[model samples]
Target: MAHVVTAFLRNRGRILLTRRSDAVGTYSGKWAGVSGYVEGDPNDAEDDARRELEEEVGVTEATLANTAQPMHITDGEREWTVHAFMFDVNHRDIAPNEELAAVEWVHAPVICERDTVPELWPTYRRVAPTLETVQTDDAHGSAWVSLRALEVLRDAASDAESWEVLVSFGRSLRDARPSMAAVTNRVNRVLADAAGDTEALCQRAAAEIDAAAEADDVASAEAAQLLRTEGYDHVATLSRSGTVRAALEDAGPSVLVAESRPGLEGVTVAESLAKKGLETTLTTDAALPGLVADGAVDAVLVGADAVLSSGDVVNKVGSYPVALAAARADVPVFAVCARDKIRGDDTVVGEEGGALYDGDLPITVSNPLFELVPSDLADGVVTEEGRLDSDGVERVAAEHAELARWDESTSSGADAGGDG
Candidate 1:
């Protein structure tokens, strides 16, 4: 199969408009959006969006989704289901980069009036309508909260006054690290409960996580080795033996890749895997298929930042691409994560629907944090309890739905920068 790639680009509004640089192949300078070539792996749309934005416009990881949408477009014979994102920019001036010959923002009507690839027109026109609908849908409206809505919920959860909410939020951060603010708030909740005071919890938790960061806080290196010896196996994880690294050590030797980014999760995972006596081979974002073709990979056991309901998983920016590649290769992909990552609502089309925008570098940037992998992309989910399929996602969610204290409704909560 050819590259079933996705793109993330700006249009109307404070659009990070630019002429596509001919530095790369394919559509060169004909004025297309930020595009990516699929590495014959699973397509993680949100992450691709983030990566495209960053690679093209030098966006920081802070503000990637001001106006983001998951859309598919046909470019002649090639078909790409891209996550089209928009952001507001107040640029004093405009300039082009290596991938973009120029960058600018214009009015929506004028943008709509411009000539385009023609094949992508329908997908482009739907952007505003899609954004409007996804933004307005309330938390109670549906189970799958659009990506934009997730940001709102994270904000609401962060502002929550209840200690349980805060602690739960903190556990969310540690278990998933989806949103730093949410995690901080949750950590504060834990400290607040312990100290019986709301003040100064953030300062304290940081201190603890930092100290904990030094010495295998989740699992001692010795303990990790013991777990590895005692029928536990480690899979995909950060390079160090934190919680994720420990899990990979317990599983040992997974078919992995080097996840590059503002934060390189794969570098950490690869370095650690080598230490654990695992047969780990690092590959590029594009070489996934070749490995699969060679039959070198047995299964995909990756890590996650959060696992949403409705069977969608949020992971590193590159994780979705890897999963998409794996899925296409007919290899089963299992996410090795704790149950705590299950967000307020899972069914919400997390990354596929929502995106947030924050200005990074200058006024031009897109720093997407998480990619949404639908249950379909996953062969199974491996938790501490064991491995389960996407169907089990709904089962666990439904079981939790009965808990009167838990709200499984569609969350109007904004999910900006909520991803790890």
Candidate 2:
């Protein structure tokens, strides 16, 4: 029920505008950004954003961030909420889409000084604040988000219909109540800027922690500080999250085991569990049926790359079938994750990472880092707050959405991916 749009601005003080090629839809003849009234389309905002951006300015997912301004206005009896975004890109050859006579790069402030579309001006003013970009990236080389991945995962999350994203978000917030807001704020701010590298991320985290500390937000600030420190250690190979030990501690007994894919990640899982004093039975992809049919296991725990709003998990290639097997056997399948992996209510696990796949280009394929496992198969989700149900997840998420403050340095969603 809202109208959202995006304006891609370049750092050289130029804003990209598109003129009306056809005059049938809203504001046909006027110049606009990769702008459009949001279809209010569930689970497809990223896709819509990407499509519009490319159509208007010929850019790809690796060029924008999840930062947009909400412009609320009323045109006669019509009311709209357009989220105009500021996207920066280097200057390149421009091929104006027939709608406009010409395209030029002008200072952002000049948009007001120049004689341009009347309606477009107001949109710029309101959108500018939202586009102020909480974090300023000096590097400004290149930036991007998993536009397509976000689109596909959001669709799967909604279509599953068995789980709602709010469940997990609420769970995170509730459990981490004191510090959630600050954490999210910091993380969102980092994301807004073009700071994707490891150093920038840590710097962002440290800044957030300092902010929290100043605000006297001890719990979250401390968490923020921890992540910044730990995250830096991880990237620099300075510290580790206990490679095999953690999995074994969580798996309990190896009987309820399923291997992850890509690099047979399950080896990490099985080895970790074995070290942790569990009866681990490591099996291959085919052995799933025999084990489940024979009533061999009581539960399953798998790692994930991302989680959708509808409680569908995007895990490794083998994860989906494991979930299916667990469901058929009436056994509970749980997912173990740390606080950094949590993105709002849904994990954004498989989304916003990269082109689904990138190994062999030219023949580019979508290499989603995970698969969707419906909530029905998910017996519970384990996080720092202990095991949470779908509803418990709801509460935790609600509790933390406002408080789960993350800085730029953490929650990179860098560890895993799923099958496309």
Candidate 3:
């Protein structure tokens, strides 16, 4: 039996696929991820996977996202056990070794059409986010969940046999993250615009995924502009928000990050910003509001999981306190997100987390994943379209509500059919 490792390098919602060259010993002229024989013991699979990524594609700093159970394949009297890894790379600079002839970065679903080695798509599936992953993910913000929702729809579109099936699956993705308006709005837009056409739906979904990512980028730009305009040089934030990170990076502001409890996502954010050369301070969640009130933080910038029609923001649990502190200190508080994050209604679903204490005591502990920040606390909302006033927020909320009409229409049709 032979052990090998396949590394899928992902960037900006796409994975890297390389065509094997004639110089390769096995599966020559076939599409594959970065693959090579695992040197030494099978326990060395992760190290070998990293080695293969650097050796084959010159990716020395890619972050390992996931690893899957080993898959066993048979080829003409030889058994092969393949270890799969998915890595997140920051750039697309590829210098393929002699083993690869060509390289392309494409959507994961596109791999279904390529002539690849044994069970390539299946192996990719093992590492990709499923409905469950999206539902249970606590470390990432809503934007990340929304992107994963799109990935789920993309995978379902590849396998769905009919428009009805695709719509059903899209609805499932929409509901996967109940508190995330971006996920619901994006999935709803794709379903409604598709208009019962599977091919068109898949195409639109792919485009929408790109558009969603671009929306976040543009929103971050808008926030960065606001930071520049207001001369808010020191920003305080909690939790891990990709949008917030991008905005801070672009605006070049020193940051005060709260170590959000139960997850400590802010530690990751602090480390990331520090690596980017931004002066970042990591503090306990309890200390952040005090710092903001003490005039150490010039502004409070947070990412919203859902922006309600009332202009209230649903975000990580610690956001409300930060916003309150900023408000008391006369510091401007901004909630940054794409327009799709604005929900049609004021409905807030607060998800409860498991108990952090493992003791045998019978005391009840409460841990909510998110909380609501009233509209008055936020000075402005920075979106892709720029800063939104109350009227602008209402308009965007109405647009999101309109996008969700497809669900109501579908339900009505189902009810009518049942009555018949």
Candidate 4:
């Protein structure tokens, strides 16, 4: 078995595919990306990619965008581990060397229609363009993919050995995004309730994950109805949320959005609301308190990363301040989330490394990804289970005792507290 570097050089939404000339040792007259055998240290895949790009395309101005996990392929007598990479080329013009017949920039969709080397499409599919997009700081997109990934794992786990495989699968999903309580709670639920035959357990887990995915849509509708009932004609929000987006569509309220700093997720939210013709205001994060105090906003609405047993809400870094100001101004601040978010007592304040600045600065940079807002500061917690106060949050936490872990090592194996 050997390793090879296969890179897809892209620019302006098009990929550069080269036809292999007969001078190549193998796969002659085939359409493929700039690729080569691993000649240096195997761990230095990026360096190998840069070399391949320079040697094949005769260009040195390309940026590495995304690198997918390596894929192993067997071709009769030879097995090759292909390291797939996507590089953004500033200049698309390329002069093919003696190893290429022709080089053409083609759209992604056209690549499937053209003749290509074996496993090229499969390898590319592993790292679809959406993979890069989902990794963005978009909360809803990340949760959506996290659920999808769990469902995929559940399908695979159905045929896997019990206990160990389930544990490993759950751990992987939880570790993939530790700050995401939705993912952690969902995986933990499957682990907690895993029973009966392996196939049956996996099926149950898949159903639970699937139901959570479906509940996001339902929660949005329910939350929207709640907002209307509560007479929140104008809403102030921070960051972006799919559930919130759906609720806004249904509630039809004028929106004030904060420019969620570092990532600016709120900018995206504000633009989306404006595009839909909803009365929208895009303001700086510092202006949220003033808006609430001046009665410029009717209510402060936000999403939760995790709703703790202590009745605190863990969310975007600035959420606490907005809620705190709303509380001071006698404005109601409501956290709208699905029941899935109502898990875990511990708060995971993820680090936003280098998001604020790059290159070692003389001063320290603090970029905490999430923050905790005391539940009392929030007027109410709205979920598919309806609105809940701090007491109600505690009741919900007790009901799902299996998930209300204050620490990571406190999980009691196979202990389903009740009909949560």
Listed per model in order, the count of residue pairs whose N, CA or C atoms clash below 3 Å is 53, 56, 0, 0
- Model 4 stretches with alpha carbons more than 4 Å out: 1-142, 155-163, 196-198, 346-348, 353-362, 403-420
In terms of TM-score, the best-performing candidate is 3
lDDT of candidate 3 over 1-420, digit per residue (tens) = 899998999876778999999999988999999999999789879999998888888889988778988999886887889999999887899889999999999888888889998889888988987888788888788998888788778777877898777777788889988899999999999898887778777777788888998999999999999999999999999888899899999999999999988788889999999999999999999999999999998889999999999999999888888888888899999999999999988899888888778999897888898899999999888999999999999999999989999988888887898999
Give the alpha-carbon lDDT of every model. 0.45, 0.44, 0.89, 0.72
TM-score of candidate 4 relative to the true fold: 0.64
TM-score, per-candidate, Cα-based: 0.40, 0.37, 0.95, 0.64
lDDT of 1 by residue, 126-161 (tens): 443232333343221111222222222223232459
| Candidates sorted on TM-score, descending | 3, 4, 1, 2
- Candidate 2 TM-score, true structure as reference: 0.37
**What's the lDDT for candidate 2?**
0.44
lDDT of 4 by residue, 320-414 (tens): 88887887778888888777776546555474734556668676677787788887888777877778777777776665566534224333433
| Model 2 agreement with the true structure over 1-420: per-residue lDDT tens digits | 466665656432235665655632655565555565566563455566666666665666335534444656676766776665555553445555445545665434434445544456666544442212222211110011111111112222222333224223322322221111223433344333313343343333334333432322222233223333333111000001121124335323344444533345456556655666766666676676557655676545454334443555555555666667667767666655433234456644332223545566577466554456787777665554555556655654554454444331233332222221
User: lDDT-based ranking, best first?
Assistant: 3, 4, 1, 2
Pairs clashing within candidate 4: none
Worst lDDT run of 10 residues, candidate 2, spans: 232-241
| Candidate 2: regions farther than 4 A off | 1-186, 189-247, 250-252, 256-259, 345-367, 398-420
Candidate 1, RMSD to the unseen true structure:
19.3
